[model samples]
Target chain A: MSTSITLLIPLLLGIGGFIVATSRARRFSDVGSGKMHSLPKYHGYLVALSIIVPAYLIIFLWLFFEQSVLRGVIVNALPDALTNGATPAQVSLLISQVQQAASGATFGNPDPAIVEVAGRLREAVVFSRWALPLVIVLVGLATAAVLVSRIAKRFRARNYSEAIMRGLLIFCATLSILATLGILLSLLFEGLQFFSRVSPIEFFFGTRWDPQIAIRPDQIGSSGAFGAIPVFMGTLTIAFTALFVAIPVGIFAAIYMAEFASPHVRGVVKPLIELLAGIPTIVYGFFAVLVISPFIREWLGSIGIAVSPTAAIVPGLVMGVMLIPFISSLSDDAITAVPQSLKDGSLGLGANRAETVTKVLLPAALPGIVGGVLLATTRAIGETMIVVMAAGLTANMTVNPLQGVTTVTVQIVALLTGDTEFDNPKTLAAFGLGLTLFLATLLLNLVAIQIVKRFREQYD
Target chain B: MMENVSFATAGAHARAPEMPVKMFGRKVEVFYGQKQALHGVDLEIPERQVTALIGPSGCGKSTFLRCLNRMNDTVAIARVVGDIRLDGEDIYDKSIDVVELRARVGMVFQKPNPFPKSIFENVAYGPRIHGLFKNKAHLQEIVETSLKRAGLFEEVKDRLDEPGTGLSGGQQQRLCIARAIAVSPEVILMDEPCSALDPIATATVEELIDELKQNYTIVIVTHSMQQAARVSQRTAMFHLGRIVEVGPTEKMFSNPDDKRTQDYITGRFG
Candidate 1:
């Protein structure tokens, strides 16, 4: 019933009802000796909203059930011999075939029982598809007429209109909250299944992280220890190294741009800095692997410092370059937002511009700058493409930036990229790693926000 | 304490007239980009006296104020051509160091702009940059004396380590004053320093400025005619980019030589 009219009839009727309601309200107000509460358009919108919302909801609800009811009738008609060997997925497929065949969609070989059931299912679906839309149209028109009829000289259409607007706004707001909850729930359930096979304690603290477990029970190479400590440490090392490279350079550049750079110099340099940010991270990763790594290795050899060809510094350096624009742009904005009077005060006191920046501008802009750096740090931590391509995928627990290392994100990708049975703990461990990565980034973000908030509170 | 105070007071007056003009500007004109902002203006700022420039909006009073120490040099498009002398030496001379000039001629702006730093650090910043003190104790003394002179020491003494931005608007302005004084500049340029302050804060700042003139040559630009009258010894009224009248504050406010100055003072035209 809901599907037959291609969903346009009810929509048009709803819009028409809205127009009539508003026009009628306007006419009533004109005849009476009173001020019209809301604009005619707003009143019309409110009537339209009422007509569309309920009928749309009813149509959605009917469509959601209509499939299940039709599928059930077809499923019941299938032979027991066919059903015994079939999985739930196959049964659904068979039901779909019956549905299509009934609709005259040239289905392949059908069972006699399916033929009978399919005929009945087709009649019910066709009838409902047509009848349901007509009913909704009638319901919408009747609801709109009723609402418009209530409009009179004293009607508070404006207040009702405002309420509807608020509800619409709230409906939009729920999307993000629901998406976050959905992700957390799916991860939690998957993690639970993985934990059932491998104890949570061993997964967290075991020293070995060899995850070559076979999908079949008889198969074996490495049973795989899923200790996450090394992966976590690697992420930290990369993030910290990247931040060390980025923060000082980014901050100084920001200060120079905001406080000291001449307009001519700023005009030339600011866009170049932003251009660095615009380059794709994947491209940066490619550069790290092909160009930066070899150059760093050469430099290290000259200095008599031996480093693996796949040095962590390779990816870290590229990540830092990627982050430079983020930090500089954000810090520049923060510094610029600091009142000019503060600079004047410092300069008036006979302080040099450098002193003024260090003492006044930097401190004033510290909270905002810190927020930017933290955001960049999180980006570096969860970064995958650069680390995967340049930083070796061997999980080596070392603090040296010159050493090759792999982060949790890379390990998770490696574990889950191949096809494997769901029961295998090796594959399941990827979910656990993902959860940890999510939590660490989330925690850092929460703490950063709190610090920024407290800093803002000081000035406010 | 009272005896010493009186003796200092008497000594201050005796030394006041003995000091010669520290800064002099002749036939000075300032241009921002292609637009001329300051017309030919001649003025002698005594070594230790409050000289105020007063005018309506866009009269170039602030531009004239910035010209004292070459603060206009910070703006790339701003051009100044003419002789500005510090102690009879032309400041516009090629050998001049702007950093040193700015150090000698500190400025306070209309709004309080305390750095987002500890109150102690804010005051120490100027001195530290100039290498004014030998050690921490000497630095502390400079901070204390500067704050005391700005009339902020007593209120902020216990909370010296707190962020200067945490202070009230009045205290922050005074803190800025203290920060400026910490560098021990010969002259102070204030551009409408009290415009952002409430009446009480304005009064406090005005009192501080009055006391400060004994040690520092002061040039203040103000839009408020009443503020110029209260704080200045010599008043210069500017119209457009030109100086309309220059004389003792008393004569300028009571009986101006220029009709425009007179009209501006009477609130007839701005």
Candidate 2:
């Protein structure tokens, strides 16, 4: 039978076991005190689950290992001259070539000894495809029959089912957490690999940031520099520009929504503000490139100053608008959470609305606002598309926002975007930059959490 | 001004005539949305004395107390249709700035609501915002005097810079009172300030309230009849959104003229 049809064998066995077990359970309860330990359906579920889980697990395992084991056996059976002292990469490539020849795909002229092995590989592949399903069907049916015999009135099917459910829930939760740690660890390892080739001090503190390396043995002017200071400083300058735009406008807009605007206005305006965030960063990058940069150039040119269309401030400014909703939404929640009684207390003391907001409300909500600001800062620093498209790729060290500059993320993209060797520092630098970005965001989140915790403790 | 329309129309026939009214409300009514919380009611608060509003839960006594300083203004839909005068000036008039009115008539909430700040900053907040003090030493003196009068200085004097939230429940309430007093208002409103405190703290705050009556006109709303009797010179009994009786504390406790007041005070039912 085909593999696709073979999947139905386990499912059919499970359904048959459930039917037989549930009938037996129902009869046992009806003939006795009518007090089965668990319900008849639970007994069915227990039998069904036992039949399905083990059967499917065996099928999956067989399918997973069948090809690798067959390939290894075929490789061993090949003539000594073909396999002797071969490196792993060479042997693996030969095995793939053999497999390709077996599949009737054109692989150039092969020796007669190799032709014999390719024929053997085809025979093995066909045999295993059939053997795997046959074994699976037999194992699935046998397991189902055994489980059917075990289902009884007193079986603790509910407990067993619940335990499995709990295990599954924990597995799913751990799966995501593990994925995050896995990403961070992979970044760290690759970054370490990059650092092995590049000296730490030169990479970190060196002023020059050229990342081009010589491709030919006699190529000149190919001494690559990997100093990250200029890139990081560019990131900081851009992030600060975004913050300078975001904090006041964001917080005041938040205050207006929380304290001043009518519910009707807030309901419409708040979502409209958040819509800025929902727009793709690529779109913001496009806007920065086409609209904002030209406006800045034209405006500055009129004033007898000049700037590249790809000035850092162009992306930085649009990024600030994108971050505004991010800050305002969180700040709104923080401000809204301050107790009304505190406001009353201040107002009752004859502090005007402005005085109450400035002295009492803001201070009480300060920690929360700081947390929001930190989160927004991290987001701005990690932002890629806008900087890549609008901010030039030159890792300039100048603090002047109008000059073209590149951020760490922008450089990381540039480094790894095209076909490149992983061993080269230029390409591996992408992973290093990724690790740094991850650590920066992780630290900001840690601080934000601590600030939020301190704020909660104050109220509690 | 409301003596004629009140349940105590016999003020002229009473033994202790009413002191010159410090603040009076005429035909006061409060509405939360469409529901009337306080029916048309008239009440007078005499100067330099503690007057307590005693009633069962949801009896409009607290509602009436909130109305005195227009504290209800904070509630968006809470409507007050009445004339409330503070020292003979209509406080509800559009010309009167609510901020200045609040500074002149400070309020203490039922729950202690001290700002999340140092104890010293908590007291100095009102003055700093209102420009109540001209210099640092002047501000310090005002804070110390307010704390002293609230009877909390000696315990917290050494730790004035500590967070106000760190104080115990009773101390926090006292700190709230000190914060209110720092504004140096002519009248102070207390809304069940001692309810959250223990018996000993309750006694301490009650004694302080009695001492404070010699300086400021105090209006307090209390659930405890004994608390009302112990701290107030005049007690007003409210029932079903109306004033059931108003008299001197001794008379209100001993020989209440209204049947509802007698029942409420005698613990027949609240």
Candidate 3:
């Protein structure tokens, strides 16, 4: 049987169980002296889940281990002459050749021994596919019969269904947390390999960041430097530039939306501002390279100042534009969240709107606003595409916006892009950079959460 | 219809001894969106005395109170038609600045809404915004006298720099009152000011209101007949957006001209 057909048998059984169990539970409720503990539909759901859950679990487990277990069986059944002294890679290649021969798509003339093994592998695969669905159908029928027989007037079907629902929700939650932990562990392991090759002290505190290892000993700049301070500084400079552009404009926009603008005007304008956030970051990268970078160079040149075409300010300005809606939307929420009573108290004291906003609303909403700004700061730090297109690749340790700079994200992309050897220090260094970036943003998010928590406590 | 006519003339009957009217409302009507909240509300607020507006919920008592300082303007859909005058100057005139009008007439809300600032700063905010002080010391002196007048100076003197929101409910209300007083307004409007307070806090605030009437023209809106009777000299009873009766507080509670006022105050029906 095909995999889809195999899966369909459990679904059909579940539906059949549901119909049978529902009618049985309804009969019990109608004929019994006492009331049924749960509704008939809950009984239907309980039986359906009991059949489907275990059947799906078995099918998934069988499918997950089927290929490896089949390969092990095929390898053991092979003669010693065909498999002796073979590396694991060669054995894997030989297995693929056999699988190809079984599928009737052999690339070249095959060995007679391989053809014999391929016939056995084909028989096993066919037997396994048929056995899985037969086993699932039997399990489903057994569970349905047992559960349907156990149904009574006082059966706690609702509690069982509720427990199943809670387990599903917990599984979803645990799945996401485990995925995050998996990524962190992978990064740590790869980063450890990189750190073993490069000293951590030099990687963190040293200023230079040239990661190029010469192919030949005679090559110029042969010894690669791994200092990350310059790269970190560059990241800080660009992020600060973005914040400098985003903060005031974003806050003013928020205040205008929250306090001054009419409902009609706010309704029209807020979505237009948030639309800026919907544009892809790569498009912002293009805008940085084609529009902002040239504009900055020309504008500064007109004022008799020199600047690189791909200056830090290029991507910084575009990233700031990207972050505007982020900061403003969050800040607008924070400002609007301030109690209207406080605004009334201020205005009742004869304070104008400006005084009321500055003296009352801003202070009350300060923590939430700070949290929003910090979140935007992390976004600016982690941004990659725009910097890749507009920022220079050189890790310049400078605060001047007119100079070229590189960031950690840009360096990670540069390191890991193209065909790479897994064991090389250069490729592994991307994991180190990724881990650092992750830590930095994680610390920032924690602080933002703390601030937002305090802010919520203040009012609620 | 006849009852409307009879109650409309009730404000002209049972008048108390003559006193200076600080605020005059002539046929004041308030509308929020399309719904009319107050209809032709005619009343007089005597200078340096508490004029209590007593009614059940949604009877336009609080609406009329907010109209005193033009606080209703903050609600975008709220509209007021008619004349409200402070010291013979029409407060709703196009020439009037709302900031200046609010400075002359302050208000206290039902909920205690002290700014999330220091205790000292909360009171000093008004003086600083209105430039009511010459120097830091003068500002400090104004804050001190305002807090003292609100009867909160002794309690909060040791924690002038602490957040005003950290105070007790009654203390925060008093702090808001002191904030209003710091600007030295001519009139003060209170909208169910003790509704959020415990009995002890309510009594304290009521005593404070009694003391406050000697210096400022006070208009208070309350649901409790006992509160109006205890704290007010002049009382106006509003029912269905019109004045049912306006006279001395004693006569209104004792022998109200309108049946609605009697029904409201006598616990028959509101």
The runs of at least 3 residues in candidate 1 whose Cα sits more than 4 Å from the true structure, single-residue gaps closed, are: A1-7, A29-34, A76-90, A96-132, A214-217, A264-268, A293-310, A454-460, B1-19
- Per-residue CA lDDT of model 2 for B160-252, tens digit only, reads 999998999899999999999998899999999998899988878888887887789999999987787677779898887888889888778
User: Chain B TM per candidate, please?
Assistant: 0.92, 0.93, 0.93
**lDDT of model 1, residue A274:** 89
- Model 2 chain A: weakest 10-residue lDDT segment is A27-36
Candidate 3 positional error at A279, Å: 0.8
Which 10 consecutive positions of candidate 3 chain A have the poorest summed lDDT?
Answer: A27-36
lDDT of 3 by residue, B1-270 (tens): 223211312322334457799999999999999999999999999898889999888899999999989999999999999999999999999999999999989999999999988999999988899988999899999999999999999999999999999999999999989998999999999989999999898888888888898789899999887788778888999888999899888678777888888888877777
1 or 3, greater by TM-score: 3
What TM-scores does chain A show, candidate by candidate in order?
Answer: 0.87, 0.86, 0.94
Q: Residues A1-460, candidate 1, lDDT per residue (tens digit)? A: 3354647776788778877886687676364454766667777877887877777778888878987876776677767876888988998887777777787776567677777777888777788778777788778878887778788666777788788778878977998899988998888888889889888888787766777775567885677878777777778888888888899889988988997888889988999998988898789988988899888888888999998977778888889988998899989978887777676666555567877787778877888899889889888888888887887778777878888888888888898886766678888888888877787788879887886677667545
**What lDDT does model 3 reach?**
0.89
The number of the candidate with the highest lDDT is 3
Q: What stretches of model 3 exceed 4 Å from their correct place?
A: A29-35, A77-79, A215-221, B1-17
Worst lDDT run of 10 residues, candidate 1 chain A, spans: A28-37
Q: List the residue pairs that clash in candidate 2.
A: none
Could you report the Cα RMSD, in angstroms, for every candidate shown? 4.8, 4.9, 3.9
Give every prediction's interface RMSD.
1.9, 0.8, 0.6
